[model samples]
Target: MKTTLSKIVLLSLWAATTSLFADSHGDHDWKPLFNGKTLAGWGVVQGYANYYVEDGAILGRTAEGSPNTFLTTYEKYGDFELKFEVKVDEGLNSGVQIRSHSRDFGSRR
Candidate 1:
């Protein structure tokens, strides 16, 4: 009877331990967008504005009421995971464009 109880306890403990990390995969290839020191593969639209890297993030500041400035990816992607950290300035008006299309000037108000 003692041997059976010991086997049951060991089996229960092993099952719990294995179930805790059952979904953990040892193979993953993670790619980062920013290189943390420079904007090597970034494209900027507004020529008058300035953009630089600060603390592993792309920083863009408007140059005296300039037009809309956007930082786009140099490579085009159809469907993939794109993750990044973004911080906006205080009281700043901005916009973000995702998988979208543009219309003609007269068609849009």
Candidate 2:
């Protein structure tokens, strides 16, 4: 009887661990936005600021006499989570825009 109970407990523990791993695997379906080589699906607008890829990172440098530059995605998303690492110089301000819109001059009819 003792051996039978021990076998049952071990089986239950194994099943629980398997289920935990399966659940964790199912939660991850992340897609990367940057390709780390180039800005394939991103765009910049309304400024002279420069953006480029170096050392496996997207780098942006502010240009003199330029308006506020924006690096935006081409695609639209309703809801999502974004994760990134940013390093900026001191006394400079940076931000990320979400669910933004641009005015269309041609639509004025």
In candidate 1, residue 72 scores what lDDT? 52
Any idea what lDDT model 2 has?
A: 0.52
| Candidate models: Cα lDDT each | 0.46, 0.52
lDDT of 1 by residue, 42-90 (tens): 6666434566665544555555555655555465445434332333445
Q: Which stretches of candidate 1 lie over 4 Å from their true place?
A: 1-28, 82-91, 100-109
Model 1: pairs clashing at backbone N, Cα or C within 3 Å: none
Cα-based TM-score, every candidate: 0.52, 0.61
Worst 10 residues of 1 by lDDT: 100-109
Give per-model CA RMSD. 20.5, 19.7
Candidate 2 lDDT, tens digit per residue, 1-109?
3223323332333333233334335565445556657878777777756666655556666666777666665766544554333334444555656687765311111
